[model samples]
Target chain A: MTGNVRLTQVARRWDAIIIGSGAGGGVVAWSLAFQGMEVLVIERGHHVPFSPPDRDHLRNHRLTQYGHNVGPSLDDRRGMTTGDDPTSATWHSPLEWQYNNNAMGVGGGTSVYGAQAWRFKPEDFRMASIYGVPEGSSLADWPISYADLEPHYIEMERELGVAGGRGGTQTWPMPPTAPTVKGQRLAAAAGRLGWDTQAVPLAVNSVPYNDRPACVNCQHCVGFACPVDAKNGSQNTFLPRAMETGNVTLITDAQVVHIESAGEKVTGVRVVQRGKSMVIPTDRVIVAAGAIETARLLLVSQIGNQNDQVGRNLQGHYYASAAGITPESVYDGVGPGPSVATTRWSHGNDGIIGGGMLADDFVLLPIIYAKRALPPHAPTWGDEWKNFVRDNYRRTLQVMGPIQDIPSPTSRVLVSPTETDAVGMPRVVLSGTAHPESVRAQTFLLGKAKQWLAEAGAEQIWGSPSGQYLSAGQHQAGTCRMGEDPRTSVVDPSGKIHGYANIWVADTSVHVTNGGFNPFLTAMATAIRTSSLIS
Target chain B: MPIDAHLVPILRAATARIVPTDDLPGAAELRATEFILGFPEYADSYNAGLAKLPADFDLSTPDAQDSALSQLSSDDPHFFDLLRRQTIEAVLAQPSALWDAMGFVVTA
Candidate 1:
């Protein structure tokens, strides 16, 4: 049932009122529902669009023209910050602060994400202990280690029918999809450069598995809904399983306004269903509405901020790229790209506190690709510009990496006390940037990417730059960090709020350091781990 | 005359300068002026951005337009940024011919 509408009065209170039915909430919902617990999942956006993203090229998740591909109308939603206006002069410039571009449908970001599922390495957990803390960084060891979460990672992979092994070094439930033209080129290049390359683990199918079809190599993989339902996400996997258990009721388009809490215990949630507002009662509450919204909700509810640590420690991976026009056409319309990667550079770089995973570019939307891959000297709208794109479109290759970022308390999500959204909730405000060390590492990673692309036959190399701005794009994470110390974290090692036992946070918000790779799989593992300890 | 009659020439004049035609038709000729001003709010924003242009400055020539708009970019960049993005988005989204000319195939 979709929400933000008239509410049906229910006398029965739910066992768990899970917020944001994306990767995090979806995992928890399935786990508890399998145990026969009655769970209700509330989503701020509608269900995924029934049609494939091929329905509209001008408007989709990747393009984000007028509205969301699977979310509410864009005009209906407003935030205090516009975006990370990279081209703007000032840090808080109006042009650079688009605060809410995240997909918010029944599946959350997973519905339209390029599902590059990855597990964090052992070194990611003990950053402070191993490398020592850099200046102005809130770098610290995670309360839980990689070993503690490895089992859950494997479980999510199997449940989601994830493809790709450690390229023969490790094993998976299913094998990796065969390399595409670009992937094969990148792998060959990495070998020539003496760097190791492996097929990236994808939450997309290789062969037909668990009743889902194999990927057909449609290039619309990055930001479009799969027509065949092959791309595995919580929307297709966990959410369905949870509902099949007959213990979970999904309420879509239900924007959570506030938490009705009596001291540390959350009594229920105030929701705006359609246009009317009502309170849905629950015994326990789980907040999984991404890092920014999760922190914003906690701030508005005034429950988890008892120690003043609720919305702090905001961070995400800063992705930088090195794109160049290759000598030959590499684009064959294959899907969900940058299909090959090298985790060998994910860590263990000298003088660099952290490194990143480098991969080829994703299959891009046309306009976005044209806008991004233009040459420096070409005119913006002249014959030269049109000519350049025509000549170089297929020959272009972009090797990029989502470099791990350092955290600071200042890089945070705050509610604008003065500004309010349409539903009368305080608008979400984002400020701060990546740590200087992280920025420096991004520069280093861009050089590494340039090397890989050049070895792969890139002739005219023009690299994309990274900034020190707060990163909460598709791979956003780290806010509402989990730790043993209440002073430094909002949730405990088990994902319980510092003070309350019934309240839990199970998203990338719990990530201490969002690793060099994509974060959805890690977020799911954390969600599963949190659910196991939720009794 | 779509949303605002007063805004159309200004959009055509300004977007032509932003995306002037040298070999192929410029943004205005390619109907990108219609595209950059596709959204009502974006059109309004583009008009507001153009309000900062120097009086008596020629919108006819590329040099004159670039010189005039460059001065206001750092001072009031939000509007300029919106205009830049909207204009580029409009041009890039123009048609199959544009992609075909560029040899780029946008398909499902």
Candidate 2:
């Protein structure tokens, strides 16, 4: 991490070029710039302007069947493979299913994220050690321990202006939003079920912070940009801090197609800007595109492939849900939903190596509610479906979260030899599903959610069906996993690729496990910790 | 949504079966078929999937329609699932007198 170049190379020329201005890259850019180092952040998506269209229930980021609110139109598809056979299926499949979950914009996923900020438990850092690595599962321990990341986690929470503390305490920077009516009922129900239901820390402004107004209960919270600027995404937090430093230049709509590297070093990146190809030279490069894209980029670059572990061990949460017909109307219609959560099952479930935190679900948009919420095999059409929804939309409560995934080397991202992107870079091929134990844990946790909902006055309860499709989507992680051993990992504990001097990864891509909770806060914390050691 | 002139009957029958008029106003009353037909983005898939049944297959009665839907779903889960989802969505998306009838209320 040592290179003292002349100021001539620092004029809008990046000292450190970060690809993808999402949570991880955002923190990294701001951290470097705060240290007075010139940094250039490149984002492949637009700086989406928040407008009324963002409130479109059917077309927003959460429900993309009709259209996408994040700018990549339905036609803007990416190449990917299916199942475990990269050679079987081509990239012509729908992007919604195959490209893995990613929001294309300056804020990246943070723009429309539900903002569930969470820290992985101590056991999450040592999966294989706590419970021996099961055969056929590529699960292993993280190089860095949770103790090593504790300070950074707190730092990330304070910097991002999160709201929440244990048992709804207001000890943090901002008081947690009063648990929604849904939250209260769920908390009581979880308590009755003997689960530790508590307030969740959210990367949302509960009170005015940094001059942004508090949440207005905008119903379109999860997949839409905050109209009042109450949500503290990387766009509102680190991106501005980086910009205000006067040492960072954020270039949006600049898609990097290649990382030009020669003999154990990355020289610069080849980007397509405004339909023009340009090269930005830099001594340091941090690829935080995403778990999927970062792995794809590394594999495409043909560097960081010493052990061929670049795109292996791709992991994401096996998200499962349980919904109940609450006797009372729990539909508060507040913007961000399911503020109450129980981490009791996050660990110590019998015979289960991993577990997930169960929380009330987000404020379901009308269309999203129609798509989900209801029990399985509920009528898809007709009097039964319509009457059920009409009767239950207000009476429904969903409890769900991401289940920790066991990594599998076979389920991975690879360079597609045939399918190429618009820039001629070979597209990513991905396949795999959650390990059987993770699925078993999902079912176990789902029962708890069902019981909690039932205790909370739900006369009838239903569990969301589980799927075996490669679970990697929005909570995608571990593609370019971090470990002390270079043979098994792409990046080291410092996030630098093994044996590489300046090339590093700081996003969920470096996650050893996706964790029971949301992974965004951990990704930001990793960025904070990694940037502190960059120089 | 502008109704597909030729596919109107099938769409209406399908929508009726999916959300048939019961004690309440149903799919036809809500114009679910017209709305779903207007969505060209996924209408082709639905049109192609529904076209599998005989042109004159009986869809007038609930039992017959339900049987057809079950068979279609069994034969091609993706198409039937898509059809079911889209039809229900069309019914639920727009303003319907049903909300008032069902005692449904949107809260703040």
Candidate 3:
């Protein structure tokens, strides 16, 4: 039988119904389905095709000036506002930068992500304890510590077949891929500056493991699907394993509009699929629709918010980057160019509240180089621009990091008062800016990135500091933040919604403070930990 | 057709300014007009923007053409934004010669 459920199966009562088929939802499906619980996974977007290798230079996730290879469709719109006035909101398509879209296919951002599977630094969980919360910031310590999630991190790493250097007491499943030319150059630079550098923890394969082939080292890695089927994601790993157990069924192109409730517990989910609506009964309902949509779902359902804390503290990484040119060619036409990282600056800096890991950047497609990595003073049009790109394409090197943003209660997601999506459900309204401290932290990382580039014998360096807008994009988190007290948070430490018994949130929505590194591994580890506690 | 037959020359001329041919072929040789033709949503904008241009825009000198395109940027920035963005992307997308010229290696 096919793993994709039929219309008849949609009416059957399931043991659990998980909304979203992302990093969190996929792991939850595996954990519960292996225990013989009949699970139903509802994904809003269909699976992106891996074959034929969609290498659309303009339309992929990174350079979305035209469109995206995977999508929430152009019609899937949201409103972004500045103040409390809803009338002043600007409606944005999913393709627009202002919308802050995470990919919406079967595996969500995991499908198109670079898969930098980083474990949050030990100090990351105790942010407010180590460094006092800055004024006008909502930064706080997590209810759970890194020590509590360590085992789950190991399990998830093994599950995703992570290839990286060993950290404290844990070994990666596969040996790290040989360092890229840029990675080696930057690692030497870090050593000279008296900072430690290591192989970036990647979920992509280095050898033929778990039936997938080794990476072919193509340039089109981060934004496009892997041409070699080597990049491990929830779609290629946990979801398939969950399906193999024969206890889970996935329904694609099905949007969960609301979680139905009777008294105190969620009884079922109301899904809109292909213009038709249906109710699928479940004993437990897990909301994993990323950060923005997860809050919108809870708001639409009008549950888990007795204290009005369902959609506050929205956060995404504020990336700081610097690019420069070396005398020799650093580009070896290697795939997945980000192979080295330094976590020495993740915490314990002089005056910064929380810092971030610095790493070499991904392989820049020509279009991306033109738009993002090009120096500000460089010519935009005509022959000089063309000549500059041709000459410097092989010599450019960039260092970047995701600054651990200081969370603010005002930077939030809300169900729009007026705008509705194609299914007539209220669309999301994203508003507010990042905390001032977050901008300071980002600027600090920008300086560090430039130092690293300069140490590596760079001739000219240029990069802009990030401004304090709602930073949520691919690494979006902290909407339905987890806490010990229901008055200040939406979910409990175990991811259970505060007021609801059978409802929970298993995505980055429950991030108390998103870590200094990429958040996917932590999202997966947290999901595994949370699902194991579910009866 | 999404783009009018008469406007094709005008479209080509405007796109050429975005990524003009020097030693290398630019948007015009890379079929940016054909790429723009694939988007039906841009038909109205392309038509309106081309109509606002000088009647002899395609026949004008390179300096005169650049002046006309610059005028379009201020007159209707939305259309210019679309044209400028789409032309650059279309030119950058393919043609193995362009990839080789730019040192962009696309491995299978």
Each candidate's clash count: 16, 6, 0
Q: What is the TM-score of each candidate against the true structure?
A: 0.88, 0.90, 0.96
Ranking by lDDT: 3, 2, 1
Residues B18-107, model 1: lDDT tens digits: 666655555777676677655675555666666677644443466776766666667788876677666667766655455565554544
> What lDDT does candidate 2 reach at residue A421?
66
What does candidate 3's lDDT look like per residue over A1-535, in tens digits? 1435554567889999999999999999999999899999999888887887998887888767668887777777778887756557788877776557678888888888888999998889999999998888888999999999999998999888898867544579987766799998888888899988888888989888899998888888888888778999989999999999989889998888988998898899999888888888899998999998899999999988889787899998898899998898898878787888888888888999889999998888887787788888887666666788888888899999998889998888887778889998898888888888888888998999999999998889998886667787668899999999999999999999887789889999999999988999999999999999888
Q: Interface Cα RMSD for all candidates? A: 3.1, 3.3, 1.5
- In candidate 3, list every pair of residues with a backbone clash: none
Q: Over the stretch B1-108, how does candidate 3's per-residue lDDT look in tens digits?
A: 477889889988888887888778888789889989988988988898889889888999989988887888898988888888788778877754667876777776
Worst 10 residues of 3 chain A by lDDT: A1-10
* All candidates: TM-score of chain A: 0.94, 0.94, 0.98
Candidate lDDT values, in order: 0.77, 0.78, 0.86
Kindly report the docking quality category of candidate 3.
medium
Best by TM-score: 3
DockQ of 1: 0.34
For model 2 the local lDDT of residue A150 reads: 90
lDDT per residue for candidate 2 within B22-102, as digits (tens), equals 677777887777777677767667767778655665445667777777888888888888777777777666546665554
Model 1 chain A: weakest 10-residue lDDT segment is A86-95
lDDT by residue (A75-175, candidate 1, tens digit) is: 44333333332122122312121445577787898888888888888898888898888887889999999999999998999998788866645577777
lDDT of 1: 0.77
Off by over 4 Å in 2: A1-12, A71-85, A92-99, A168-170, B1-4, B9-34, B41-81, B94-108
Badly placed stretches (over 4 Å) of model 3 are A1-4, A85-88, A167-170, B1-5, B47-53, B63-81
